[model samples]
Target: MFDKLKEKLGGFKKVLGGAIEEKEQEAIKAGHVKPEVSIKKEAPESAKPSETVKAPEKAGIFDKLKAAVLEQEFIIEEKSVKDHLWELEMALLESDVALPVAEKIVEAVKAELVGTRRKIGSDTGNIVETALRQAILKVISVDSFDFDGFVKKSNKPVSIVFVGVNGTGKTTTIAKMAERFKEQGYSVVIAAGDTFRAGAIEQIERHADALGIKLIKHQEGADPAAVVYDAIQFAKAKHKDIVLADTAGRMHTNINLMDQLKKVCRVNDPDLIIFVDEAVAGNDAVERAKLFNSAVAFNGSILTKQDADAKGGAAISIAYTTGKPVLFLGVGQSYKDLIKFDPNWLLDRLFE
Candidate 1:
């Protein structure tokens, strides 16, 4: 998924390895530790000593020198890693990482590497990768939310509203969530609350029909808030375990549409508000998430089109921007392609 970022991090690893190696060599040249071979060259035949040196004594000296060299420890100073940090910063920015997020990752890497003690000849690449992984993890794990745990414990017919700008896969994500909940043994009801756009109701109805789940929808130009309210009432009567509402996609700057969204929430009082966006949208996705959170305040986010994302910046930036966890990732076209977001899973994919 994050092919570009993976390549960039690999480059950073090489740079880090070289920097550490150079620092180790500089320490050795400065006589900070004993050399591995300190024994004097065997005397030329013409200048040999009359008495032969003891083999055991010479072997002991060689072992001591080797031990001294292997046991030496070097501290990773910030100066040595400065270039690496700069390169990392540029790489992150180019990958569409938000400014603050890029800065946070850089600072984290510095905190993890600077002044750290490592024995001479340790695996430098492994060390760099570990530090980078932890830094990225810190950036994305700002808030961790367990989707299944919340759904299991929440009251019956837990209502969730999906909000985001247009063309960010909001409808598809709603269908995916409905399938997920159904597979988990919960009866799901879908609300086609996106009444503004033509075919919005038909789009959701097709998914509901395919999934054999009930859908509550209104005709075009109908009040979206009314649709959601009706869906909640239907769920209560039908004993449905969850209600997933799909709202019309609207820009945060659209005062009228945003006001309609507020009305929907105020009237229906959903259990959770999930912002949907595309991972491939990069910095734009991050900005939209921030704006949406400021206006309506979503609980979590679902990032779609991850399978097509080469940079994978939105996943990292959205969590930090919204102070909310990424509940799910839409990986492909199939309903089953929606996978729950896990920090470790992302780290493994990026680093491995």
Candidate 2:
């Protein structure tokens, strides 16, 4: 899912490498540029036999060259670390990491590097690697979620309801989830309860059509609760293995919509209330999560746009603040973009 982003970043890295090399060359030239100098010494005028004197040994060209190279190497090494750390910090900021969160990350990385001794062997690389990993883990560790505990094995079908703010990819996520369930050999059905947006029903319909799954939708501006009720009834009648209900994305501040969402929950009583959020939403994403939790009490989260330049703070902060597991991450816009959330994999990407 992140293939495009990876490729783009690879090209950028190449450009940065060239720039750093040019800077290093310029530094070397400046360092070795010799300055003309005249030395003045006072000598006694007394009539005394001049003693044989020796000229100070001149440093060889090779020695001068070697010293210059070593100096450049040392400068490059220090700059490389600082540059890499700065890149990490910038990437996090671009991904919507809050100012405070970004600051904490930088401080953690600095603390790990300060007063730390590098080993005299290949293990030196390991020490730096370990420190980077630990700092990233510390920031993201608060929101780690496990999917293993929530996997259902019962004969009864599992019900998952998708909720989120408008434009957070709620409907599309449901489509993706349906495709996933179908691939697992489950008879999946969708409840298109997002009756607010025009063409919302059609969007879900197109996905259901593509996946060859059944969908239940009411007329435009229909009561979402009634639609969910009907979908649940159909799932029970058809013995569906799973029912995924898509709800209208509403602002958390809307008490009327929040009440309506509560009504939907009451009617369907879904086994899993999954909140769909865009990964790029940043800190505002955390606030959305908290508001949704107050309204629907979501059981888990499905983060979309993970492949985008998101600082990934939303994923961590939301999970930590709401105390909900992250079930899936949408890494791309494709059907297979939906991936089960793996904390270890996420940690590796963030730190490594």
Query: 209-236 in candidate 1: lDDT tens per residue?
Result: 9999999988899999999999999999
* Candidate that would win on TM-score: 1
Count of clashes, each model? 0, 2
Off by over 4 Å in 2: 1-95, 103-125, 139-149
**Which candidate has the top score in lDDT?**
1
Alpha-carbon deviation at 312 in model 1, angstroms:
0.9
TM-score for all models, in order of appearance:
0.88, 0.68
Global CA lDDT computed for model 1: 0.83
Local distance difference test values of all predictions, in order = 0.83, 0.66
- Estimate, for each residue in 1-352, the C-alpha lDDT of model 2 and write its tens digit: 3333233334333434343334334433455311122211222244133221111234432111111112112112333345555765666556556666666766676677544322211133344445555665665556544443444565456777888899988887888888887777789889899998899999999999988999999998999989988888898898888888888989999898889899999888888888988888868887888889988898888889978833567765666567776778988877888989866677656444
